[model samples]
Target: MASLSVPINPLPPPVNRRPDVKPEISLTAKERDEEKRRQKVNRKIASQKATSMKLRSEATKAVIGDKSGPSNSKEPLPLLENLRAHIAALRWESALNVFDQLHEQLWYRPDSDIYIKLIVVLGKCKQPEKAHSLFQAMISEGCGVNRESYTALLSAYSRNGLFDKAFSLLEEMKNSLDCKPDVHTYSILIKSCVQVSAFDKVDSLLSVMASQGIKPNTVTYSTLIDAYGKTRKFAKMEATLGEMLREGQCEHDVWTMNSTLRAFGSSGQIETMEKYYDKFQCAGIQPTIETFNILLDSYGKAGSYEKLCAVMEYMQKYYFSWTLVTYNIVLEAFGRAGNLKQMELLFRSMRSDRIKPNCVTLCSLVRAYGKARKAEKILGVLHFIENANVMLDIVFFNCLVDAYGKVGCFVEMKGVLEMMERKGCKPDGITYRTMIKAYKKGGMNSHAKELKGSFASVQKSSPGLERQNLQHSVSRFDSNPAS
Candidate 1:
């Protein structure tokens, strides 16, 4: 009965609220105020973060050469695609320009992988400073700093022969908590050292790797073997191969086989090269087109025409397609053998096969024609070059000069410098040396002396030119040596 008598409004009327209820209402208001305050604080924090990121990006852009604001026209994907295309084309400056454009896009996000790719491209283009700049920009953009990023930057420096910077960076990587050096890091450094023929440094790096319990991989052994073979360090090369074979984890690949073949083939050790080729075959490493090219090149250089022809026949028998390098190699071989008629036929055949001739191909024609004293043929090559979209480098220009000089085309020989200037290729010490030697051969002592004075000035300014010229004189005396 008492429960049924409970009032509908037991507490209070509208103006007679209890004190406890007043406290409850106050608590709800406090919670509302706290939520609003919390929201305001969050907004302030987000604003500060956005401003900091914007400022950091601005600073990074200032360092990276583009100060423009975000572009609204191009979408992010297209911009990124363009950047990748330029990089793949080996156009370093163009790639950087596209990267700048990408940075100016509103939807752009910093990507460590893209930065690493750009850095690698710059390294290949011999633009270590630019690569370093991009690496710094990657860090400033708040991109994740990891082993890959450090290795890429290290590779850039190493590729450019900046060993000091490379070593310092390696030390830095060692000190990094998140980016300790790995086998790939040591392998890359070893390859760089091998490239410069700095065997001492390579040994030091290997010892360091061993001390750190990092074993050599296939790439590392291959690099060492290739370098040693190229440098005629047979003992070291064989030792490296032996060590690689002993490592159960490092199975021999096609590259390894090619390196071995190339080492012996390039050194004119045909017997040894053939032996290794057979061994590799027995080891189940199938030969690639590069393998055939290496064998052909070696045999061609050593005047083993029969062997070269044998390799060619084998390739044809196997239905293997001829690459541009294959065409260049055979052309050079025939050219060197004074078989111009066959060389011309092959050249025509190469074009019919839609393999456009490159600088190396043109160089081969010029050198062969020059040796045979066919000035007209050299002229024909020049005409072909004018029509073709082949990219000419300093080596090609040197060959052109030699060809002209060989055929007593003094005027044309001198004109190559103008061609070089137009092509935006600076003449190296080899270029000057070739020209000077040609002038002296032509009995133009006065001109030779003048060029000699200029060369002296160049050497004085560069300090390294004389050494480079000496090496060129001793080792790379031919206009169109094997590629």
Candidate 2:
């Protein structure tokens, strides 16, 4: 077979060619070395940046007590505890500051529960503006905007007397999907409404709850009972109680019993109170220390010394440790009865039992001494006050002024104003009224007139003083054993 002549052309010689490639590929040796140096520098810069970020994160964790690790199973415990501690202490600014630091953490996640808790704390601390800000931040951070979070913000507004805002939020919740107002939400709002004596609002909230097929829980019924009792709307309170009992699902608890007993007892309905107390006990609700305290306070106020003594004896036999309220009640009872020897004995016993006398205790003593025209005994109380570490409030100072006035110690009576000023408690209407009355009684018409003029000036300077004074006086009276 004849082989065909193959004319295969030789390939071109291998050429040192870079076919329009990237600059680095076409670099000369020096250019290549320079490119390598530039790459190393870029890598070093990146490493330094990563290190700096890590160091900054570590520093932040150290400062804010956020000792988080790679495991993301739980939140940073130290950080949470620090924030909770501040919140519990009512340190609003500190709590928010810690919260901000928590947000900047690498492991931080926007949590609705945490936001809700802070909102609640701010509400209790009367910082509704801060609570709303936190709520907005929660939404921005993609946290779930559910009923609980909304209710928390609503509570913040309502508890602080921002009812208009609270109602608006309620309406918003009603219109929102999956965030409708529930029993707890209505209960919270109702409680706040009751606190501010907005009974009409409370009724409306209750109606809404009923319409929404949300049955009132024990807390709701108890709150209504307590509020009605406080306002002396006995018929309404009784009706509410009846409704609660009619609702088979909502069982009465110790709190309900306490409210009922307090209502009757405080109004001097001893027989009714005793009967209900027995009924509550029969219903398997055990009385607590608060129950007995209420009894003692009621009997003491009614001047039923025998019953008060019986209650005290019963508490002792049952090994119920006496609280400060108990001591104050008993001390005030004995003092009002002019049993100075017994009052003094109880005072000594209170101190022996490591119960430091508070403003209420001292006020009782001063009042008793003043009533007995024993100026020297009042001075002794003053000496004790000076030695002891009791925080005195405006109420206590007012009592001191009245005591000095009763004993015709005009100079000391006048000095109380200065003391109140030093303590940063401005004089309210009751303060001026008390001094004026004292001056009138002491045959100092000029002094009384001067105080009247000052009172006018204060009223002008602070328009809300009268209303606040009335509230303060009512609160003081409610707290007083004599009431």
Please, what are the lDDT tens digits per residue for candidate 2 over residues 340-425?
A: 99999999989999998988899899999988888899889978988997888778888888888888999988998998897787
Stretch of 10 with least lDDT, candidate 2: 66-75
- The number of clashing residue pairs in each candidate reads 0, 0
Candidate 2 error regions (>4 Å): 1-75, 411-429, 444-474, 480-483
Q: What is candidate 1's lDDT per residue for 1-483, written digit by digit as tens?
A: 455678886876758864464333445888999989999999999999999999999987554443233343465556777888998999999998888878776556899999999999999999999899999999999998899989999999998999999999999999889999999999998998887889999999999999989999988988888889888899988898988988999998999998888888877899999988998899899998889999899999999999889999999999999989899999999999999998999899899999998877888899999999998888888888888878987768888898888888999899999989999976778788888998998899999999989888877898875576456554544422333
| CA displacement after TM-score superposition, residue 86 of candidate 2 (Å) | 2.1
Off by over 4 Å in 1: 1-74, 90-111, 118-144, 373-483
- Number of the top candidate by TM-score? 2
Error of model 1, residue 122, in angstroms: 4.6
- Residue pairs in candidate 2 whose N, alpha carbon or C atoms collide under 3 angstroms: none
Instruction: lDDT for model 1, please.
Output: 0.87
- RMSD (Å) per prediction: 19.0, 20.8
Q: How close is every model to the real structure, measured as TM-score?
A: 0.67, 0.78
* lDDT score for residue 220 of model 1: 90
